[model samples]
Target: MLAGIVSAVLAALVFGGVAAPAQADPLPQLATIGSTLYSFGDASLCAGAIDLALEAAPHHPGHVLAHVTPRGYLGGPCGNQVKLGWVGSAGLQTRDVYVYADAAPGETITTDLWVGTGPAKVMAIAWPIRSTFAEWYLLVP
Candidate 1:
């Protein structure tokens, strides 16, 4: 369940989706803002959309750009509850952020959300740290 949310966040920023609609710019295949709906169209044209949304406000919507989850690890960057947040410091708007790993409960993750770049390949960073154990997640751009 957690992994799904992280993937949804990952889908938002990666560049690879359908075509843009005739009326508006290439719509996002599945976009949102703090549970608020946005848009979606061709799966290709809007590939870089999620990245754009996160670029606008990575914290508001709680899109963890810390790291990419491993091939099979689906544990998202959240606790058992539904509250959303990040593991490291705040995200830098306008820059490219990379998903490092899964931010588990009480974990520490670090991601670079560049402060001047356009919508590109920002990833979902997830860093889950335990007393002596640690985990991570990285997104694909």
Candidate 2:
């Protein structure tokens, strides 16, 4: 049931550029110990509200799950919407984290990200008016 919901949401993003309904799937409670703030683009032109988490994959050994939720934007004309993505070290495979759609203001998009345990750089890019909004580095354990 949960898998189907997740797959459907991912399909919505990967195939069509449409975002999933904000109230779609619910994830299991994993401890959210901390969060990081990020400002992207030249001279910190834009900022985004996002939360990140890294935890050991419940079943996949040597891999970590990165939970990224793009809450919204701080202020100003942050374009029509924003999107999330990541860059990881070489040889570390990644899945589910490649957010390909735009998230509108006040809309929350949570990703079921799985990647090989290592260092990673998460990024938030603004929409139609293309530009990077924010970025942060995470050491996936």
Candidate 3:
């Protein structure tokens, strides 16, 4: 009876330490130079706030605000609301993407966003989302 009890305890202990597979998910962060008014990162919260700075960007295409590695999207904007839907292939390769923006510590640049998922069809169920407010400039690399 004692041996059985010990075995059960050992099994429980082993499983107690077992870990779950890490999921690929989006992340958000803010720069140190960010102003108090400029909104920052939040995994659970979706707050739209802007800041102020000295200069603005020309809104270039090659501009890479951030680089997503695989299977997840970073936190930021894409571009104009009209072009956001056409930027990515809508979960084409099941890869990752990092979305970032350009502005001073406290600046406001606005743009649109395109959100979707895989294990589905070529056509995204969700489409064009024009951001009501933005900082200045951003990209998804």
Candidate 4:
């Protein structure tokens, strides 16, 4: 009976009757500048918040920012309802800053960031409340 059940399951999968598990999309490539490594992608964190993470050299000091761009019609204005913030190691976090999207689809809204102490692992989160489509980049300078 076990063999029969296994065979049935295999047949269902082979015949496309059973749906395969969805694969998570790959994160964006990381960029390096003078020793800092920065990257951004869609992150599914706790409480349904999609966030981005940045890893920098430990013991070094640097600054970061979020360049958020909203997706929409070619000539229409994009939404201006995103919350930008960063969380660092040792439970350090910066206050959230609200930013509005630019009128152009590719135009970006820049949010300045203050990262915590070094050997640091920081996560920059961009939560869009009113926008349907958006992309963000965590930049180090």
Q: Assess each prediction's global lDDT (C-alpha) against the native.
A: 0.27, 0.46, 0.28, 0.38
RMSD of every prediction: 21.1, 13.5, 15.4, 15.6
Best by TM-score: 2
Considering TM-score, which of the candidate structures 3 and 4 is the better prediction for this target? 4
Taking the tens digit of each residue's C-alpha lDDT, what string does model 4 give over 1-141? Answer: 999999999997888776666432232324332211112212321121122233332234454444444433232332333444444433455544333222333344555456543333333334433222222333332
Please provide, for model 1 over 1-141, each residue's C-alpha lDDT reduced to its tens digit, 9 standing for 90 to 100: 999999987887574565454331231222222221111212211111111222222432323333212211133332211112323233433322222223222322234333222223222212222111122222212
User: For every model in order, what is the number of clashing pairs?
Assistant: 47, 0, 17, 2
- In model 2, residue pairs whose N, Cα or C atoms come closer than 3 Å (at least 3 residues apart or on different chains), thus clashing, are none
TM-scores vs. true structure, each candidate = 0.17, 0.36, 0.20, 0.35
Please say which candidate is ahead in lDDT: 2 or 3.
Answer: 2
Error of 1 at 27 (Å): 16
Summed over model 1, clashes come to 47
In model 4, the runs with Cα more than 4 Å from the true position are: 1-60, 73-76, 89-91, 94-106, 119-141
Candidate 3 C-alpha lDDT tens digits along 101-137: 3221222333323322211111111112322321222
Q: Compared to the true structure, candidate 4 yields what TM-score?
A: 0.35
Residue 63 of model 2, lDDT score:
44
- Model 4: number of clashes? 2
Ranking by TM-score: 2, 4, 3, 1
